[model samples]
Target chain A: MNVRRNLAGVLALCAVAMIFLPLLLTFYLSVFDETLIVFPPHGYTLRWYARIWPEFGAALRTSFFAALAAVAVSLLIGVPAGIGLARYRFRGRDAVATMLLAPLTVPGIAIGLGIFVLAVLIEEHTEWAISGSLALMVAAHVLITTPWVVRLCLASLANHDAAAEEAAASLGARPLAVLWRVTLPAMRSGIVAGGLFAFIVSFENLEMTLFLTAPGMTTLPIAVLQYLQYHIDPLVAAIAVAQVVFVGGALMLLDRHVKLAQVVA
Target chain B: MVEEEHPARLKSVSKRTAATGFLGPATLVVTVMLAAPLLLLLRFSLNRFDIKELMIETVTAENYLRFFTDPFYLGVLRTTVLVAVTSTVLCLLFGLPLAYRLARSQSRWKSLCMLAIVLPLFVGSTVRMVGWMILFAHGGMLDSAVRWVNGVGLEVMYTPFAVVAGIVSINLPYVVLTIQSAIETIDIRIEEAAQSLGAPPGRQFWLVVWPLALPGTAIAGILCFILAMNAYATPYLLGGPRFQMMAPLLYWEFSTNNNWPFASALALILMSTTLVLTACSNLLIPRRYRA
Candidate 1:
């Protein structure tokens, strides 16, 4: 019994280490002074950190704005969809819910290709140039992110008592008023969590964005990938560390407001 | 009840209208943005490829036939399946015990541990692949460590091994979290009851926890399998150019070769493979535990 328990403990520790060691190594590698990474560097410096913005600043900005736009659009459309799914049973309700969540199940690369092809076909058939546009990228992001928003919002409302909304309605309040005053407030944490997830998903996305990006226009992950193809340096490591810190910090901060584990579960 | 009938009927009508109003924008967006694209992709996959015109409007299964008949593409598919299956099995092996421990742990730092597992997930696979590259690269950490012991450096980077390891790392957390939640739902008293009945630890788990946890394990496995099957960056980065996987191959066909028909066919094949496997696994699960 003791042996088994010890084994389990050891395995658990190893699992944690496996997850973390790479991240720590990325941070460690970023500090190496040498251009060509080798095992124990002679010295450490923060030069790579200083080089990140100059190297990939444009891509970073593009990713950030695209993620933000995706979040905004996802929330605008997804929250109401969640409310609709949770509050009412209408014809084709299950179908609508399934359609909304279908993106989560499909492979992202396939979706990217599909959207890219769609953009091409649309451009060929029309005067509007939809291919390689930021709007197109954001639209794809919205397609993916809306599902998560809808999911989290549904989760948040799963245990919520509808009596409050009903009470407001019974007291002569309009449906819109009740939704604004009561239902929306109830979904606040879900909204915030969904937006945060949407941002991360969009910002970190590579598969879908790879197909959508133009020659000069790219997102941060694509920028990192392209750079890695030509260069193997600590500067990329520094950028990676920065991304980890940004995402990790956001997760921790948001976890305090919304139990992200519960939300995900 | 009779007194409230009119109000109830009015409320039902209003509720239906409200539901439509609320769901309309999202439904419209998904149909237009996602559904239409996918449908168009399906159409494109049937059409003949034309280098000059991009796509010739015709219905043909030439692309699918080409993928299946070509042994080179078949080999790529086989390698992709091998990588995905290996990584998923590794994830299950590593994830189950850790998830069991995490689920049962009463430590104050449990949430922190959960955070540690999940934090890696939020970081992009590209960043994680960079980390793996540093570790597996010639003269990198693993090589340095081995050399320190044996005076001969190792080179595992850009290999199938590195690709599998990178994918396993990416998928482990997801499996762990899924199984942990499942394990959390199993009542502790059941295990206690088994213990009091003098069943050994292994038997207790097999008899009590395993059956209950089977559904979650199945789910986690399916998720990991799908993720691995569709993996792009890990294979693209760690597997290198010599090693080809479905997602990357599809991208190469579309982007480099500009074979939209072929790429679309590849995409459909990959998606269908995952869907079929997922359905098969779902059928494997006992009906009572399916919810």
Candidate 2:
């Protein structure tokens, strides 16, 4: 028994290290003084951190606003859908739920291509100039992110009984009043968790966004890709470290409120 | 009695109306954004490709035929399958022990350990690929360590091995989490029962635990396989331009070659391949083990 426990401990430690080593190395590499990345640096500097804003400012801004837009839109639509699915079961409930999550099952690249093709066709048919627009990218992001919101909201409602809302209704509270006073507040954690995940998903997306972005308009991942093609400097590493810290810190903080592990599990 | 029946009927009507009110917006977004575009893409794939005209609106299976018949395209499909399968298997092997440990551990740090596994996932694949790039680059950590030990630099970057390693790193956490949840469903008493009956540790695991865990393990494997099959950034970054996985190939056709018809066909083929495989695996699992 002791031997088995020791073995499991060793394996678990190895797994943690494997997951974390790359991220730690990324932080280390970001501060390397050399322009060309080498194994052992003679010295370190923080110049790469300063270079990120100038090099990737536009792309970063685009990603930020796009993700924010996606979060807002996804929450607006997804929470109600989650309530509808979780609180009430009607005909075609399973089908509706499946359709909402269909985006996740399909390959993201394919979806990106499909959306891109549709955008072009729309442009050709009409003079809307929809292709390569931020709206188009956010629409796609919403399609992906809404599913997460729906799932998280559904998870949040799973354990909580609907007796409170029913009691409110029985006591002559209007349906909308009951929803506002009782149901929505109960879903708060799920909504917040969903928005956080939606932001991360949109911010980090690359496959679908690749086909949608115009020449001057790009997301941070695309910017990093383009930079990597021509150069292998520490500036990209610095950007990566910044993203990791920001996203990781947000996840930890949110996990305290929402128990994100339970939602995903 | 009439009043009660009237209110009940009204309630039913209101219930449906509420469902529709809640579900309508999401349904509209998904249909307009995702389903409609995929349907249009299907039509586009059937249309003929012309360099000057871009797409000639004539129904044909030329794009699909080209992909099926061409040795180069077939080779890319094979490589994608090989890479996805290898990475999935490796993830299973590496993830299972840790997942079992996590599922059964009584330690106070269990949640912390779980968080550690999941943190990498939220960071996105591109960032993780950058880390691997540093580790596998010619003058990077691996190379330097090899040179110090054996007076020769390692050359692993942009290779299939590097791509597979990067994918495994990206996928391991997901596999562990999925399998952990599955294992948690299993009662520990069953394993203890086996142990009390004089079964060795290995025997207890293989005989008592493995059978119960099969469903979850299968789920984890399928999820990993699908994710790896559709991987873009990992292959694009770690596998380099020479590597020809399906997702990268599809993107190259769309963006670089401007072959929308072929790219659309490739997209459908990739999606169908994953879906069919997932369905087939589900069917293959014994009814007793299936959820």
Candidate 3:
């Protein structure tokens, strides 16, 4: 028992260490006011903030809007699907779940390529042109994050007693009214959690976005990739610090409101 | 009760519409449009790209031939599989024990530990990889620490090994949370009974707990395997020039080469490879339990 306890303790420590070391290192590096990102910086200054203000600011805004649009679209599709799957016994429900999850196993590049082909084909087949459009990018991001929302909301729906909805109905609530008053309120945390997941996933996604993004639609992740190809400096480190804070803050908040592990569970 | 039942019931059309109406839109949108398009896109592997046409106009099997025939592409394939497989294996090795700890702990600590494990799941992979990049690059903490230890210069940046480290670190927390909860459900008495029957902890886990936990682990493994297989940004950013992964190759071909047809073909091949790997896992995982 002692040996086993020690083993678990050590592994847990390693887990904490791995997460801690890089985070500390990144924070430490971000303050360095040097071009080389050298260790034990001669001193500290905030010269890097200037780069972010003028250069990366636009990319940051673009990524934000793109992520926002994606999350909204995902919610539009995922919430209804969540309710449908949760409420009804249907033919081939298992297949529906699997189909939603199919995007996960597909390589991001293939998704990129497939979306690219889709845009071209849509243009060729119809008079409407979606090529190099933000709508297409939003659609692609929706494809990625909707499954997470659906699965999460489905879990939430599963946990609720059916009697509550029935009770509302028995009390003279309309179907829509019951959904709004009882069901929607119940799924609120799950929806927020899933939406946040969708937001971050879309915001930081680089691979498929790398293909789908056009001149005006460059996201922060894509910008980082492009900048890194030519230059590696504390500019990215500064950006990393902000990103970690934002994504980390959102994650920690979601954890407080509802345990993230519950979602995973 | 008869009065209650009769008056409260919705019209049959209303019931049918409720069932089919809300569901059909998403099903058609996801399945018929996106899923079916992917099936059509799979043809890219069989045909060569025509630079002149910007579309795949010919079917020659050259692209697929090149992937199977060329040592360069094949090596990348092997490395991708190796990175993904090794990473998943590491996740299992490290994750299962941590999961066991999570399961055995109190509820508060379980949730706390779980929160710690899963909070990173929402953080974008790019952000984590960026953290790795900042730390791993020269003049970063790692180099300075290494220099202090060995009093020598070491160039660890841009190595495939570094890329693997970044990928593994990002994926570990996710896989652990997945298996941990699955471990949470198992009856404690099962383990205790094996102990009473003269089985040591090792034997107990091997003989009993493992078989029960196998399903969750298998699913987690599949998730990790697919993510690692399809990973693009981490490999691209951390590996720099030397690191070649499938996703980046597909990205470059489609985006830069402008040979959309050929690029589509490569994507198809990548898709097929993922399918084969998954199929293999399903067969082998069941067989492992039988053994």
Lowest-lDDT window of 10 residues in candidate 3 chain A?
A15-24
Taking the true A–B contacts (Cα pairs closer than 8 Å), what share appears in each candidate?
0.60, 0.55, 0.50
**Which is the winner by TM-score between candidate 1 and candidate 2?**
1
Top TM-score prediction, candidate number:
1
**lDDT winner between candidates 1 and 3:** 1
Q: List model 2 lDDT by residue over B56-160, tens digit each.
A: 888999999999999999999999999998988788877888899888888877767777777777667776777888899989999999999999899899899
Interface RMSD list for the candidates:
2.3, 2.6, 2.8
TM-score against native, each model:
0.92, 0.91, 0.88
Candidate with maximal DockQ? 1
Across A107-193, the per-residue lDDT of candidate 3 in tens digits comes to 777777777777877799999878778888888888888877887687678778778999999999999999899988888766876
Question: How high is the CA lDDT of each candidate model?
Answer: 0.86, 0.86, 0.75
- Each prediction's total of clashing residue pairs, residues at least 3 apart in sequence or on different chains, is 0, 0, 3
Q: What is the DockQ of candidate 2?
A: 0.53
Q: Could you tell me the TM-score of candidate 1?
A: 0.92
- For candidate 3, give the docking quality class from DockQ: medium
Can you give the lDDT of residue A60 in candidate 1? 89
